[model samples]
Target: MSLRGKRLFSVNCTLGLACLTLCCSVSPLFGQESSTSSSGRWLAPDALVTIAPAMEPGETFQGPVDLPLVLNNPDIAWDPHYAPKSDTLAEMGRDVVFRGEVYCLEFSFKPVRMIAVDIPSFTGVQRKNVWYLLYRVRYLGGDLRPQVEPDAFGNQVFATPQSVAAETISTPKRFFPVFRLQVKGIDREYPDEILPAAKRAIAARERVGQPLYDTVEIMKQSLPVTTAAGGHSLWGVATWVDVDPRTDFFAVLVQGLTNAQQLKMQGEQIEYLQKTLVLHFSRPGDTMDEMQDRIRYGIPALEDPQRQQYILDQFGVEKRLDHLWTYR
Candidate 1:
């Protein structure tokens, strides 16, 4: 077998061993499903939501950021261009001089789950409901680089307009995830928090022996590409506490899965936005006696055609869209 094949086989074996250890050794908590529940330890294949790496040509950025000379000379770091030479003209406009490559990671995740936890507060410790989203990502080792192709005749220096080409690379990738839960209509946003007590309770309740990382801890880990036989996956959970019980429809905005971003020129100022993943969900029935299991994935379909609009309005989406990617 070739070197690539041998490496893939080794990775597959390691993954299998890890799974076996979790399944055979981990003990389930009382009332915990420990298998296929939404809050279960192992991620179900049917519940996986996969988002492929994507970026547009316009999203490539090349301006004042990330310069070699700016690092050496701190005084000129604020300049649009590096320290200007006495003989050369200083760049006046904010236009991008040279575009750079855009690298994105392939992200996959399981459905969001809800759990109740005893957390601290200003008054004292109290039991509060928490919502968490589990996810994993992999690095495919390719980046989209801006380039111009030559013509068939080879006479023209540049035949086509500047475009992007895929180039293979091998390097470690990190995920600095920022998850926000937004409730439609009310326009309330809850950012994910790092709760040590909640994390321990969740690990036990989920019966997952493998260390599940929070936002900060997961950022330090590296991800590698996965093959058919095995997957080098990094598992993480985003937790939100004290969400309003009346929130029937909401979306989770996940960022940092990819390095793709957009730069919009607005007069002399520029607005920067990063690629984000939006996961849509809605719960049926009234908010009274709210339960964690009642939360369902995707937009809820109502039996009554007349009431469908009301449900759709709650989601703030025109149609039934489970998830989508956009720059925000």
Candidate 2:
């Protein structure tokens, strides 16, 4: 067998043994009951794929979703010297389809790394590092079931029990494979533009040595009571985009708050956001004026005394300003 095949076989053996051990330990009936009948069936190796934000010092994140695949390589070779005379080598490999929601837990300028390994033996065979993009991903498993066709009357239908078990048993393991993808080469648009602009604005303001305005307090007080509902929708859309796997979306959003504060300290963030709004939304050529107008009027509309307090209570001006004003 080739070196890669050998390594894969070894990993599969280790994983099978581990699974058997686990099954034996958990089931008391299997512990004392010995089966003299050897079925000659080999358990398949489990494949996993994982996505997440790049790791950072003092930060730890976990993903609940994991993509698992059962290997079904058919060209496996069995060495008589490595097994009993009657034993035959089992080959396994399979194509796995997976999808999930991803959130950014952290953001850094560092490179992202990914690794794929065979389980049980934990042998790493595939590795990649994305220099421009780093992500941590949690795999949310997908459901693959055959759908029943409707009759002429459009009646409901059911699948056979055997089909149900066949589908469910096909995806049993929860192993996660890690991968790092670089974002820089994927597009010509630089993702870092907004951040640096905000930084430069802050620096320029500080150089003038002028008194900074209390934009944080202004944002805090200007916060409308009904604005949170709209902001939540924005958050949901951002999460659905699967922008990056490694960072928590909530954390990134919070970072905007921090950036705002930093800009406030230097009297630049709000100004930059305002400038961005005017340049992008107020221009006669800009097509987004209608949306901007809605936002402008939406804030005051929620202030009506007849509205529910909960709607007003959840309003967040900082988030709105961040959305409407921030370049990013």
Candidate 3:
């Protein structure tokens, strides 16, 4: 769609976020007017995509939304041979499509990072220093199941209202997730490592008689992720939800909240959400000359071995990347 005459909707925002219409233009909406990089060039085949937020908008609790309130009693560690097995770099030079009534977002950066991994509590290969692009997810035409219910911990089950269990969810179907967990690259199905855990949990639930009646499938969903890729639109990337092997992430959220903050977030009106964007760039060290050199000469400046060493030597990787946060 041509964003020709549409004056961008502006609103109160902070950090890298700037408010824009929900169906915002794909143009670089929040960056400087300069069209080219310091080297005077634009990213090639740069794919602009929308990823559902980790949680809904609002500033009540910590983070986009606390993950612990969303996942399990126990978290699962990602497979050690996780990354390097796939391309975990910032996504660029690819095509992404999202169908059904959707919300569009654009960023003025190359290799836009898409991540959804919550460590210690939940795990599935993740990279260092990525910003989760928060967008609203919606399924076009299908049964919208309510993915929430009290868990063993007595807190909410999922982050967003109508979320789905990716492990058990069928593909070629559509869904907007609470948030899509960011990983290094396309995922491969691993063994059902959680079967033992689930069986034990189910037996315990049976003893309690409640049997975790509604969440059995979700628990079983701790199975492997499907390796399917390179297909039609929504099915490609927007199809799956992260598998919660033990719900460790969710457990943490429940324990971390102060009683007051917890009640208010689940019930009251908190800080306003103004459709904002969060920018997470690579560790600095790219001088204007370095950036210019790559753009002007078509050399892979950011990927150059020397620059890679410079970044590792400088910051050593984002221990706590503050740029991804809005408040906490």
TM-score of each: 0.71, 0.15, 0.19
The residue ranges of model 3 lying beyond 4 angstroms of the native Cα positions read 1-52, 56-160, 163-291, 295-310, 313-328
Order the candidates by TM-score, highest first.
Answer: 1, 3, 2
User: Quick one: best TM-score, which candidate?
Assistant: 1
Q: Write the per-residue lDDT of candidate 1 for residues 228-326, one digit (tens) a residue.
A: 333456667889887887787889998997777766555444667888988888766565666534667788777887688887777766887888888
Candidate 1 regions exceeding 4 Å error are 1-43, 61-94, 121-123, 151-168, 228-230, 303-306
Candidate RMSDs in Å, in order, are: 11.8, 30.4, 26.6
Q: lDDT (0-100) at residue 34 of candidate 1? A: 22
lDDT of 2 at 141: 21
After superposition, the stretches of candidate 2 with alpha carbons farther than 4 Å from their true spots are 1-91, 97-190, 194-197, 200-328
Q: Write the per-residue lDDT of candidate 2 for residues 1-328, one digit (tens) a residue.
A: 9999999999999999999888755621221111111232222221111222222111111222111221233345455777663454342222222222211221111111122211222474322211111111121222223345666788964332111221222222221111111122122221221122222333232221222112121122221111212210000001111223322111112122111111111221121221111000011122222222211112223455555343233333322221232322
Span of 10 residues, lowest total lDDT, candidate 2: 231-240
lDDT of every model, 2 decimals: 0.69, 0.24, 0.26
The candidate maximizing lDDT is 1
